[model samples]
Target: MKILNRCTLEFTSIPENVAFARVAVAAFASQLDYTLPELEEIKVAVSEAVGNAIIHGYRNRPDKIVRVNVTIYKEGLEIQVVDSGIGIADIDLAMQPAYSTDPERMGLGFVFMQSFSDRLQVDSSPGKGTTVTMFKQMGLRKARARAN
Candidate 1:
């Protein structure tokens, strides 16, 4: 697949910005003619990833940055979100359904990422921060089976 488009944005660790980030990603996914449900899935997954960066990665420090990079390709889209916050000590724990380092959140972020996209990967270290990568493929007017 060819790379069609991409975008990168740095956001402050604020709750309001969570919805803002979701809107941005949703808008970009729209260009691909993703179904409404697919777009919602993208928005939720992206929001959770970005929210993790702002909360766990940055520790609400306010000074750190949550960098979101989106790439649109012939098959679909890819995203890499990076943050200089406290990295996850247990990738497995972070991924468990309803798991969370924070109490308020239900810890569905990683779950949503896995549930919504064709692929999701996370690279991180205790001090080195974290990078989350996600991929989605846009098919014809009708949905099609993805090739492995």
Candidate 2:
């Protein structure tokens, strides 16, 4: 099954959207036949990335839009979350786990993305916003992970 769907929404820089993004991932996972273990990792990574976009990238700019794109392929699924707000100045520094621009954040978003997905690609420029693309194989690979 080859299906692609995208949604863009703007919400105030509230913490609620963090969970909301995970819920969206869970619904998408159901369509992909993601195993329970796969679903949990996807949920955590999506929440972290979406939360980073809403909190750090937008920095409370409620007017900014966050775009989430989900594509399902025969072998796996890919999810992209994009934000056209303030971008990361240093991709290397931003991706470091436990390193955060804001004191409140533990800066493990990218770390979790890498740990959870088979692949994670991040594209960003200082003023051009950031897009995180994550991919993971379903079915057998997921079952193997759960068995471990």
Candidate 3:
């Protein structure tokens, strides 16, 4: 895919940065003329991906680094959240709804990410951490074309 614009952010795996990542991605996504609801969906999906990296991947270790890559394209927006901490041994089981390792938490991060974005992909190695990549189409062209 051709990238029209791209930015990368690396920050400590702290809970606070989750909101930062969400807002940053939303701001970048705004260039595509997304509706307010669409922007909210992007923010929510980004928060889930980043939060998962902080809580599950790094175990709340503030020293760990989480990276976010945001790319804008004519087709849509592509965002990736990556962490270099403990990775999932069983991706299939991890992706299952309500299958969180933490009993107190409802494991619906993947569900929300999948629902909010046009595409979602999870990649991980047992000791190499995980990467969550998602894409959301602007859908502006179609709407604009319809008005003509």
In order, what lDDT does every prediction score? 0.84, 0.80, 0.91
The candidate, 2 or 3, that scores higher on TM-score is: 3
Preferred candidate (TM-score higher): 1 or 3: 3
What value does the lDDT take at residue 129 in candidate 3?
Answer: 97
How do all models score by TM-score?
A: 0.89, 0.85, 0.94
- Model 2 lDDT at residue 16: 79
Preferred candidate (lDDT higher): 1 or 2: 1
lDDT of 2 by residue, 1-148 (tens): 5454444444455577778878877787677667788899999888888888988888967666777777776567788888887898888888887999889877788999999999999899888899999987777865455445
Number of the candidate with higher TM-score, 1 or 2: 1
The order of the candidates by lDDT, greatest first, is 3, 1, 2
- In model 3, which regions exceed 4 Å deviation? 140-148
Give the winner by lDDT: 2 or 3.
3
- Displacement of the residue 7 alpha carbon in candidate 2, Å: 6.2
Checking candidate 1 for backbone clashes, the offending pairs are: 57-85, 57-86, 58-85
Candidate 1 lDDT by residue in tens digits, 1-80:
66678899888877678898889988987877788988998998898898889888887777777888999876788878
Question: Model 1, residue 86: what's the lDDT?
Answer: 77
